[model samples]
Structure formats: C-alpha cells, structure tokens
Target: MITNQAIEELVAKECERYELERSGFIADRQAAIRELVAQTGILPESCSLIEFAEWKERLLNDWYTRRRFAGFFHRKSEKRCMFRMVKRLLQNAVFRLRKKQTELTLDDELKMEEGRTVAFKLSSAFFEGFYKKTCCNGTLFVSPGHLETVCIDELSLLFPLKYPLLYARLTAKDNEFWEEIWRLIRRFVRFLVVDMGGKEDTEMIQEVSMETVLSVQEQMERGKLEQITSARHLLNSLQMTGRNKFREWLRTESRKREEILLSEEDWGKVEQAKEDRREVDTCGANRRFDYLLDIDEKDEYEVCCALVDVLSYGSGKVYGELVEGREKLARAMLLLYVENKPYEEVVRILYNTSDTSKLVNLRKSVSRGKEYLKKRMADLIKLYKRKGEVPFATE
Candidate 1:
C-alpha cells in the first residue's frame, strides 16, 4: 500500500530536518570531545575530531585488554596473597616502562600545531566521503528504515565508544552525544511511519496488527503463551488489563517452559545421571574431610569408620554444652553448619535483621562454635584411640 512517492516525501522531510540541525549537532559533539579530552588528558588538545576519535579507539582497546588480564590474574591468585603482591609490583613496573616509551615516541613525532592543521584537513576529507556513502546526491534514501540503519551504523563507526567508559575516564555525556544523533534519525523515521496521518500509515498499521496476531497464534500453538487461552484473548488482555498485569503474567510464565514429553529410556537416563551426581558429591565431601583431618593413607578406611562414630556421639555432647541456655548460638550453629546456609541467610533467619552489628556478632559466635566442636571431636578421637572407648564426661 506504501508507494515510492510517499517514501520519497518522507525521506525529503527527514533530510530537511537533519540539515537544519546538522551544524548544532556537530558543534555539540565537537565541544563534548574537547571537554572529555581535557578531563582525561588522554589526547592532545590540538588534535582534531578525526585524531581524537582514532586515539580514543586505541585507548579503549588497550584499557579493555588490561581489564581482562587483571580479572584473570585476580581470579587465579585469589588465595595467594604473596603472588598478588608480586603481581601488583610487576604491573607497576611495566606501566612505568610503557609510559616512558610513549613519552619518547611523542617527542620524536612532529610538532603539535602542524599535526593539528593536517588532522583538520584529513577530517574534512573523511566527512566528505562519509556523507557520500550515507546519502545519495546529498539526500537521504527513499526507504526510511534503510536510511535509519545506514545513519546509525555510520555514526557508530565514527564514535565507537559505548557504555561502562571506565578505561577512558569518560562520562555518560560522551555516550549521550552519539545517542542524541541516533535519536534524531529514529525520531524522523518514527514520525513518518507512526505520527503521519495518511492512507499509507493506516495500511501499515493494519499490516502490523495482522502480523502480531499471526505471531501470537504461532506462539500459542508452541505452548509458549500458556496464560492466554487464545490470540484474541491475549490482545484484549494486554490492551484492557494494562501493561502492569501483562508484565506480571509474563514474569510468571517466563519461569516455566513448554513441557517436553520424553520416552521412558530418556527418563531413565536422567534419573541415572542424578544418582551418579549424588554419589560423586558424597565421595568428594568424604575426601575433603579426610584431607582436613590428615588421616594416614594406610589406615584411612579404619580411621574413617571410627571417626564417624566418634563424631556422631561427640557432636551431640558439644551441641548440648554450647546450647545450654544460649538459644541464639544454638540457632546460629544450626542454620550455619547443619543447614549449610550462608552468613547473610542465617542472620536473616535468626535475628530477622540486616544490621551490620548483628551479622558481625553472628559470625563471631559461629567461629567460636566451630572451634569448640573441633576441639571436642579431637579429644573424643584421642580418647577412643587410647582406651578403645569414649567416656560420657565432658572432659
């Protein structure tokens, strides 16, 4: 229903709008770049837009590489304090060496004033080529969507900076500069398609509605739209019930997936996999305790059997002695060790408090409880070994 004539008219209107605001947009971007350069001191002040853009790309790339390396090293050396200290010292040394090398290279390059003039000429030529590629005869293409895509892509290439500008020391304002340009282009396209009142717009809306209905029907058949009884119901519910209600329904349904009916053999395989995982976890836990206790390799099986029985008896006595009127410590130990809950979870469950002081007290109590239990267990094991029996007395 949309003709080339209508498309051309929309494009022409958009082009006229862009031309009117082009100078202001360019000036704003130039000012922002100058401010960012001043703040970061990453680029020379005399550098033109083209030089600055290139330098920014290189700096961001270097920053990303450094961040990735730092993350990897941190994770690998998490438990090694000495290794981490050594790494920090080495990194500082390398940074100083690189800084010196950069200074030497800058001294050898041409003077700043001459460089600025040449950069300005190069930037002008670059913009000329950029305009030719993005426009046909200095006018936007007839297809609004295509023109929008082309403009956005060209703008992104010109300014490759994105969010999380940590390395460049740039602020959100730098990102907003490019975003504003994209918004202007998108606003023009949206105005033509959505706000413009004409036969073409009406036809376009109807076509889109039909496509939406078909898409909903397909999703329903695939069991993805579980809450909606039908496509019409979905449309009505979304429109009438409002976005909040629709969002709640989506949130609930997103946690569930379409049920996949499997054969008996497949079910059997899944069960077997779960059982194997449990066995592996049990063996791993046992091995961890054995290593912690430093059990002799030759007598591991015999010592493990005796230690299990000793632990069963000793744990009860230790718990009773520690919890004799201290209900908070008892509950904390139960939630921390018995339930295997995290410190925050245990604090919440016991005191129902997120206060920092409560968390600190809970941690201290848990640490003392752990030491008492370890001492009791060790004494019980030594007694059992000495006399072949553990006495019921606390000592």
Candidate 2:
C-alpha cells in the first residue's frame, strides 16, 4: 500500500532528524573529551600522529565498551555521546532539587541508632547521586554492598573498580595520584554522612574510612608489583624451550620472584615478556582470544590500549613473524577486529586492493590467528594454575 514517493519522504525526514541529534551529541562529547584530556594530561592534539591515532583508538574502544552496560533508558537520548554522562547530568539535576527541599534523611530510625558502629546503607542510586554531585566523571562499577563498612581500605578498591580504563592509562609516576582522588571521594562521602548526622557522631567513622583507603591502596600497589614479577618469572621459564619447559618456568618464576627486584632497565624485559605471550600462537588464535577475554574483564577502553600496544610494539615479534612484512597487518587487525569494519573498507584502507584474492587471504589469516591465540591461552592458563595466578579463562 506504501508508495515509493512516501517512502522517500519518510527516509529524508529521518535522515534530517538524525543529523540534528548527532550534532548535539558531538558538541557534548567534545566538551567531555576536553575535560578528560585536561584532567588526565593525555593531549591527543599535542601528541605525534602515531600517538594521536592510538589515543583515538582508545577513546573509540571506550565509547563502544560503555555502550554495552548503558541499558535502553540511557541510550534513548540522542543528545549525548556517552550514556553515563547523560545519567550523571540527570542525577546531578535531581539531587540539586532534592537538596533544596531538605537535608539527607534516613529511611529508618535504625540508621540513626547511637551505636559505636554507624550503620550506613549504601545504595546504587545514592552512589550515583554522590558521584554526580561530586563531579567525578569517571565511570564506576560498584554494587550496592560495595561500601558496607566505608573502611578506607575498602574505599581504595573503588579507585580501581571505578576507573579501570584510567588505571590502565596511568604510568608509574601517575599511579600515585590515585591516592589523591581516593582522598577526595572519601572526604565527599564523609561530608554527606556528617551532614545527615552530627559531626561529633560521624567523626570516628570518617577516621576509620580514611585508614581503610590508605591500607587498601598500599595492598593494591603491592599486588600489582607481585603480578608483574610473576609474569617475568613465567617468561624466563618459557625460555627453556623443551619438554618440561612449562613446569620449569612455573617453578623458577615462583622461586626467583622475591629475589628479582625490577629496576628501570627491567621494565623493557617485562614488555618483551608480554610480546612473547602474544607470540605463543604462531598462526594467531590465542591473540584474538586473549583480547576478547581482556575486553570482557576491562571493557573496551583498556582493550583498545592493549591493541595499540601490540600493534605498535609487536613489530619484529610474533605478530610480525606471522604477517611476513605486510606493513598494514596491524592496521588491518585493528580495522577488522577492533573496529569491526566491513571487508571492502578494510581492504581499501589496508592495501588499496579490494580484490577477492586479498580478502580471502586476510580472512584466512584471522582464522589461523585465532587458533594460534587459543593454544597460547591454554598454556597461559596452565602457568597461572601452577603459580596460583588468576588466569583469564575462556568463556
């Protein structure tokens, strides 16, 4: 019953509306990106072309990853690039309105009970409100029970959970800044709790919370160093290259771990270890699997950075060996796998050869790469098991 003219008109109208909506989203995203760049000091514009491209990839991956958990209600608004940003703005407005009406009132008298331990109930909604009101633009992944005790140690874990992408972006010197952010959040929480009750009543709770954050940050840093050390030991064991190489690697890595303190020079060795891990799968199954598994754990932002590192640094390494001097192999991998670009477009960009011959070869390489990655992961899992390291298990 629909005429061709009517369909064309409808399509035109839809296109016009989409363009208007997209314009608004672009403006908001630019503003947010500006703030993020300033805060993190990772200026893509100031960086070299290669660094800028990697930064762009990281942002694109982050945006894609956040979309997964953003639910329909958040995505319905075509006026923002990030659903989390929209949600934060909405929460901020609502909280401001509520603040004007009254102070933070408790749901029950039990919350006001004068016991030595203050019984504070942490809710997801309240956490969102707090984060929004404080203007902490970083995305969070905390359950309602995450702040059950508000212990400083427990609160420090929030930094890692709240900003996994940011955590991955940090260098050694930048890592210390987490303590400052942690302190800010802790103070914000204390202000809210104290506002709800008398300062005298909340003083002890605030002190305890501060202590918790400090202790937790220390523990987290220590654990990170241990993990890096364990990875190095495993890589050394792999160098044996024989029947019992895997077993020997595990034993040696654990035994020498405490003795081997990493100096600045040793960091390069660690990066080489990661490259070896990537190289384990010759045809390439394990690399893809490793990436997929990490994406699930870290969301897209961290995964994108990981991809950039591999592509940028893996030259003359395992990935280079497989591609056999195909200069565009890394770009091809990013376009095909990370960006999920179409075959025709990828070929055009990668080789300017959109023929079936190249397409077939690219497809085969991907398939073989995945197989190789899986074999590598299997070995990785075994090594983790031996060292009591939590392996990135395949789904």
lDDT of each: 0.38, 0.39
Alpha carbon RMSD to native, model 2: 28.8
Model 1, residue pairs in steric clash: none
Question: Per-residue CA lDDT of candidate 1, range 1-395, in tens?
Answer: 22344334433443343331232222343343343343343445677879866764454334324334334323332234323333333334334443444322221221212222111111223333444554433442322233345554554443322222211111212332223322322333333445434424533333233333333334545666465443234334323323332333334334323312123454455445334433323323322122223433234333423333333333444335434565566566556434457777887888788764466456556556644544444554454456543323231
Across residues 1-395, which tens digit of lDDT does each residue of candidate 2 receive?
22344334433442243332343323343344443343332453456779865654454335424533223223332333333443443334344433343333221211222321111222244344444443233323231111112222333333212223223322232433443434443444454446645463443334334443444445456764234332223222222222132233235435434422233344455456556655434443344324333333223333334434344444433344334445465566657554558766887887788665466456546545534533443444344346553422111
Worst 10 residues of 1 by lDDT: 164-173
Badly placed stretches (over 4 Å) of model 1 are: 1-330, 391-395
